[model samples]
Target: MSTPKIPILMDVDTGIDDSLALIYLLASEEAEILGISCTAGNVPARQVAANNLAWLELCGRSGIEVALGAEVPLLTPLRTTEETHGPQGIGYAELPEPRAELSPRHAAQLWIDLARERPGEITGLVTGPLTNLALAVKLEPELPQLLKRIVVMGGAFNYPGNTTPSSEWNVAVDPESAKVVFDAFSGLPANRQPIICPLDVTETVVMTPEHLARLAEAADSSPIERPSSTDSHGLRSQTSNPLVRHLVDAVRFYFEFHFDHKQGYISHMHDPFAAAVALDSSLAVLRPATVDVELAGTLTRGATIADWHGLWGREANALVAVQTNPEEFFEQLIERVGAFARTIPGI
Candidate 1:
């Protein structure tokens, strides 16, 4: 019997990991990418859309709709992390100029229209802030019921914040939008709840230099180079495969950023793991909760609090992923992406 294909719509900020998540979906035979919605987070909405187009062009995949969303959060001034994801959001990996045209539709409209067109069949994967998705929910209250599921990579429940004392970066960037999305999902069926891939679970999924080498080897790419902290600050990949080369250049920056923060030469493969879970929820061990984002306290704004024990007396609005296996995830990422890269026309 053939494996079931998942029709997925991606909402991303095109961070380093978001790029990887997009590529992983492209690599997977099971993912039928319906479209992509870009929001401002890692860099900017326009840059995010550009990264999406470049990646699609690199993988020789085409005709996917790429739309730009709001440039700022619902209620706050925009903030971007060029230091973390590089100015263009793909590290040192310079991509060829994209030849495809951007979708004329807005990201919010894309979300609303696609959900209406493919209700109960499309799984939405959001790997950035919640601006676009929140707007869609506000426009169409039935959107929560329309999507088959939403896999979100935000929040930091049960984990320390990477941004503030209490908030994850994505949630910290736009807490109001996050709150809106969670509130809209209240009273939805268990299947309709968003699978929250918060920092609690996502940060534990680490990517190391060895994993990069393994991926290159799996692709049969020549000159496998495992990036290290001791390497020069501007080292770039010289592999024969264009895909592996750009990936190495991109992830090396992520590894360096983590190392500089004393987190070792490793990157938390947050978004790609969420991408995998969007297709197969079994990849994560989930626990239902009433997930809400804090928007008021001076020190607690953007913090995500989970009512794991039903203390709130309301229905659980999200399914929070509490645990996942890093080893199992990396193995599949390597095997699947490596094989897929081999099939793409190399530069």
Candidate 2:
């Protein structure tokens, strides 16, 4: 039997990992990307949208619509990670100017419209701050019921944060928005709650130098297959496809960052792992929990407080990922992405 295609809407900040997540989803036959909503996180909202478009164009999936969302947090100053993602948000990877235009509708409205159009069929994958989603929830209070599932890549849970000792970058960038989103989902039924891929789980899913070498080897060995037509739609394919090369370049920076700063050579598969789990829930071991953001603590602000033991006697609002099979995750990523690279038309 054929696998059913999952309609998905990705809200991204288009950082290095977010770009990887987009590539993974584009390559997967199971994902029917409905649209991509860009927000401010790793870079500015406009830059995020541009990166999304460039990636989609490079992947020959530019038919998908891209929209720009919140330039800053709902109630806080915008903070970006240009140092982490590099000036262009993809390290040394260079993509051609995007030929596609951003959709006129704002991302929040697009989310609401899409959810209303196909209620309970669209999986909303958020790989950025929750600003756009928080606004959507406010505009459409029934959004939780409309979306099939919401997968978020944020928070630190029980792990030390990349941003601070207690908070992750995504949540820290926009704590108020995160709080609104968490509270909105918390009031929903158990089944309608979001599935959070916090740092506690994502940090465990690492990509080593060995994995990068393998991907590079695959790209080196792949044959160049160009399309017959020279139309604008034709993709630029080559033995060293842009996707693979870009992944290598971008990840090398990430690997170096981890090595120098975190004293490790392996980069955490944070956003991509969230996308993977969103596509296949069986990839993770999730535990029900009531999660909230620390809003008022001076130093602990934006920290995600997960009630793993139900100490607060509150109902579970989100499913927190605690375990994942890294081997399986990498295997699936390589297999799907490698296959997609081989089909691209000429460099």
Candidate 3:
């Protein structure tokens, strides 16, 4: 029997890693992406939407609706990581000009509408700041209860943060919104509580040079050829498969970012790991914890404080992923991505 595709809605900031996470979800057989909501983090909200639409076009999955979300945090100045994802929010790659426009509805409304339409079925995955999600919860107070699950790719529990000494980029970019989101879902029942893929687990799943080379090899083996009528401006027209070429170009910048930052030329598969866990919770070792986002601290703002030992005397409200098998994760990624590459039209 075939496995059931999990109905999902993804909220992303279109960072380099978020793009990879999008590719992972688009290629996977286990996920049925209902829509993608874009927000500001790695770049501005408009750029995030553009990147989403371009990526969907590049992957030939333009049917998925890409909706623009909050441009700034609820109570903070917007912060972006252009250095990490580069201009246009897709690293060194330049996708085809999107043939489609943004969905007519805003991301928050899409979230509310989808949750109401598919109550108790849609699994919402967030790989960016929580601005859009917080707004949706505010619009519909019972949004948390309507969704089957919420998988977040942020925080730095028991690990040093990437944005600051105490905060991950996603939460640091919008702590107030993150706080609202955490508080909203933390009150859900045990079975429906959110699952957080913090830095502790995501950092363990790194994409090495070897993996990139393997992906390129798989793409090269594909029978697809570039189309004669397609325009090649801003794209690597030399590669037979546009999707594979775009991915390689995009990851090059990410690889350099890690190398210069002393991470040994490997990119952290943060968002992709979260995407994987969203589909298959068995991909990671999870522990129940009472979690909250720190909004005010001289040196610890935006920190995800996960009380694993019940020291806070609070009931566990989230599942914190502590460990993941990198080998298995990469194997599955390679297989799914390879399968998708094979189906790409050579343009």
Candidate 4:
């Protein structure tokens, strides 16, 4: 008998890396994307839904259920990273407006209803704030047990924060919701616990211009384009392949941002790496820990703390990614997404 395809319920903010993550999952033959839940993070929830719908239409995979979540965090005021992603959250890429309609159900209700319908079969992948999942847990207390497992891309355990000196972007966006999630998901079995892709490891998964060129080459696109720092800012890719061109344009803005911040002209593929690890946990070595969110602090609100030792006296609630082979990961990403691009109707 053929092995069953893994059901993936993805919750994303549809930022650039989140876009790549969505495409990467679509490329995987074994990943059955049950549905997508859009939330406010990189951009607003409405724009996020539009971005997702457009990408699905662009990739010729329409009709997939896309649900919109909360417009703001549970407690904190909503903040978006238009500077990091573009005004539309996809940088220079311009996709036509989607023709598909969104699911009528709210994102939180979608999550709860899916878990109830597919107990122990659905795996949650959240690459944004835990707002929707938190709200879902509040409505359905047995969510953690009903799902097979979860993979999250947030936090800054043992690593400096990207948002502030103490907090990562996603957690910083919604600490109360994160607290709600961590508290609700406590004490799950080790294998079933959330596999969190913290900044400690995700910051190491860098994507250079050469990687984009390689991705284009993998798709057999002409000219083998390489974006350069010397080029004018906002310079777009004129590659023969449309998908590669959009990817180049999107990541070119990411490269420029990193260069301006003195982190080199390399973009961190955080959400894509999280998506990959969600599909195959063997790609990285995980260390079990009792993790929590710091909700109230003089200057450390929204920081995530992981107790590697037994000081917390709590059972391990998360399996944190500590190490991964970047080369292997990029290889898989290029191979999968690039080949999938080749199969597009217009390609």
Candidate 5:
């Protein structure tokens, strides 16, 4: 019998965690990636697009469609910090230049087309600003009904944000877009499961030293491609040389960025947590709740106020992730990485 097809669409900013999530999704036999929509945040718009393409190529799954999303927030200025991904987004991978043509139809339009083509069966794996998604809903107004779910990596319920005191990076980048998605989702009935992996739950899981070492070991042993004189590290050789040197460098830079800048040794696998939860709902403890985005406030803009107290007797519109089984998630992540590693050349 043929494997059952699980269709998924990804909206990402191509950060290190986003790359990990991509790898995880590709490794799973449960999913058939329909496409990836690139947005801006940790990297520049163009670079993030390139990073997405490079990852697709590296996975040997170049048939996946890659669409470029909004470069700036719907109602806010574009914000990018190299702190998380270096200037290029994939750390210092100095990724090979992408020659692929950008999709003519903007990400929002592409989203609508995909939903209209395969209504009620496509899952949105969102890990960046919701500009493209909001644009789609605002333009069509009937898309929410067609979506399987929106797995978003944003906001903060129990934990503070990485970008601000009360705002997560994805939402903080575009609160207006976030509000649009939340409102549209709320307008939909409870049948549509809009699961949110907020910072509170995501931060609970971090890239432990052991996990990083394992990932690095995978990269070191892989036969993946390497960068040349034009790439970041500028190393040139092919005889018994590691092809995934760039991946190891990316991990090292990611760790250093967290350690030196955040004063934390381990960075939260925020985006991947959302992806994992999206792939397998049983991996985390989930609850149904109503969530609202704070669009205006001196210090609380972009805050996701989840109503778990039942103080207002409000109906629930979102599924809030309360907890996760870290061991299970890590085990699955490691297994996927190992599989990819075994396919690489020159350990």
Candidate 6:
């Protein structure tokens, strides 16, 4: 029997890992990208869209449709943390001028239209704030029924948040939006409800040295090199480091900044892991449960609380992934990176 192709719609902010995840999806033999919608999250809304187009053009996939999504959070002011993403989200790679034209339709509408076109056949991999998804759910109540699942990379339950002590950056940036998406998915009809993969599980998935090397290999193949390392902003330092070449250096600097300042030893390839799990459940350990998002707590807003003990005896409303086979995930990620590394034009 032929392998079934998975249709995916990526909602991203074009963070470094987000770029890597997009490349993985586009190159995966089992995946057929439906489209991409850019949102304002880790980076500014304008930069996010530009970064998306840059990645597509770099990969020689200018044909993919790019939809610009929400600039600010659904019900909150926009939040940006350059400390985590560096000045530029994609490692200060001095992105080339965008070649992939932005779509005429908005991200929310694009999402709804695509969902309706292939009901129950599409998986939504969200790696940004919940603004776009929440807006889509609000506009089309029937959207939940059309998606196969929504694997989100936000919220913290057992693990401490990267932003606040209890709230992850994505969720904390827009708790109201997160609440809306969570409620919609939970309230959907039995068969229409999508799965939730909050940071409770994704936090544990980190990238290894092998993963970074693969990414570097891919970056080294970029055809367009910036004239200088200090982009227009004078942020990145010019370097002749062989390990940090072209775009790879930007990512390396970003990684080092985190390591030196926050002591974050591992790059938790968070978003892509969530996407991978949605594509292949065999990569994770999922448990059925009732996941409650805290929106009013002073310090816990955006935290995902799971009734894992069943102490409340509440009916399970979602599937929450709690663990993963790290070995399998890294292997798959490395393979995907290798394929993309080979696709760089004239490499």
Q: Write the per-residue lDDT of candidate 5 for residues 29-145, one digit (tens) a residue.
A: 787889888888888777788888876666566678888888989988899978777778876565566656667777888889999999999989899888889988999998889
Superposed Cα deviation of residue 287, candidate 1 (Å)? 0.6
Q: Which pairs of residues have clashing backbones in candidate 6?
A: none
The C-alpha TM-scores of every prediction are: 0.99, 0.93, 0.94, 0.98, 0.90, 0.87
Task: Report every candidate's CA lDDT.
Answer: 0.93, 0.85, 0.86, 0.93, 0.77, 0.73
Candidate 5 off by > 4 Å: 187-191, 216-244, 345-347
Q: After superposition, how far is residue 4 of candidate 2 from its true place, in Å?
A: 0.6
Measured on C-alpha atoms, candidate 6 has an lDDT of 0.73
Q: What residue pairs are clashing in model 1?
A: none
Model 5, position 134, has a per-residue lDDT of: 92
What TM-score quantifies how close candidate 4 is to the native fold?
A: 0.98
Worst 10 residues of 4 by lDDT: 338-347
Model 3, 250: alpha-carbon shift in Å?
Answer: 0.5
1-347, model 2: which lDDT tens digit per residue? 88899999999999999998998898898999999999999999999999999988888885788988999999888889988887888866778999999999999998999999999899999999999999999999998888988999999887898788899999998999999988887767666679999988888888886676566455553443322222222132243566776676677667666765755766888998999988889899999999999999989988999998889999889999999889899988878887787677647
Runs in model 3 deviating more than 4 A are 221-238
Q: Judged by TM-score relative to the true structure, which candidate is superior, 1 or 6?
A: 1
Error of 4 at 293 (Å): 0.5
Better of 2 and 6 by TM-score: 2
* Root-mean-square deviation of every model: 0.8, 6.1, 4.5, 1.0, 4.2, 4.5
The predicted structure with the larger TM-score, 2 or 4, is 4
